[model samples]
Target: MNDEKIVQRAIEGDDTAFLNLIQLYKIDLYKTGYSFLKNEEDVLEAIQEVTYRAYKNIRNVREASYFKTWLIRIMINYCNDQLKKKNRVVLGEEVLNFQGSADNYFAMEIQEAMLTLDDRSREILTLKYFHDLKIKDIADSMKRPEGTVKTWLNKALKSLREKLEEKGGKVNV
Candidate 1:
């Protein structure tokens, strides 16, 4: 179903519809939260709060077609609020011990390198890479101009490449 239909169902107190929407976006939301807080527990809490707030204030959301962006904005705000409440602590390096595949190693390394970036850079990378958002969508989600998003994206990629290169791994654009 279209997001508007789903949201319309949800607005009428359809818990199932709301839950379905949450399920659809939960992983993406959690990963975005994790990118910011780098804590599984904090990510979970933020996701929970985002869902509650979305449900409680569903009436305030003006348009259903914009639900995904609206939800992401809510998640970002919740994560930021949580960060303010408790300053972020650096997370330990992600372990690649689960699978010895080269892809796993590279993913862990990238995650570690991403951790080193400033929050905005990290978020841009996460939105672009992990969430698979288009540059335009990312700009809208971030409330930044398209040109600014492009600039930040280029700078962020360069920063990440340098960091990876220093670790003896190169990021080829």
Candidate 2:
């Protein structure tokens, strides 16, 4: 069955269908969590929490077709909460391993710039660029108009560019 059908079954409290939906989007959830938490342990915790939250509130899903986006938003919100609680960046071995790379400097700059952005701007940029989501998908997930999303994306890119330029010469993030 297609995702929407599976989502519908899950909403109807079908255990197998719910598990299938989680399995289908597990990687996306992991990547989304990892992008924010930047720690495997934290990502795993986030996954568990998101699963519970999704299950508890599955009935609140407004559109079955946008289940992936809804799931991702849950992960993002959980990750953000964890970040707020921690209130500091924790470097993992994954980042340490890249310390010797030539492009690491630029990568670090981009990360720093991303951190400076407001939450909504950062979210729009992440969903648009990192997740490669379409404008319509992001707008639907954010419950904002497409034009508003596009405007936010544009402003985010401009802010990111300015931050990168401040760090060094003009460079694309």
TM for candidate 1 is 0.76
Candidate 1: RMSD over Cα atoms? 3.1
- Give, for candidate 1, the lowest lDDT window spanning 10 residues: 89-98
Per residue, candidate 2 scores C-alpha lDDT tens digits across 95-127 of: 677756658867666776777777788788888
The top-ranked prediction according to TM-score is 2
Pairs of colliding residues, candidate 1? none
Best by lDDT: 2
lDDT (Cα, tens digit) per residue for candidate 1, span 1-173: 78789888887888999999999889879878887677787788889889999999877666676677778778877766676676654553356234678887777677778867776787788778877778888887677899999999999999999988998965685
- Report the error of model 2 at residue 79, Å: 1.0
Clashing pairs for predicted structure model 2, backbone only = none
Candidate 2 vs. true structure, TM-score: 0.92
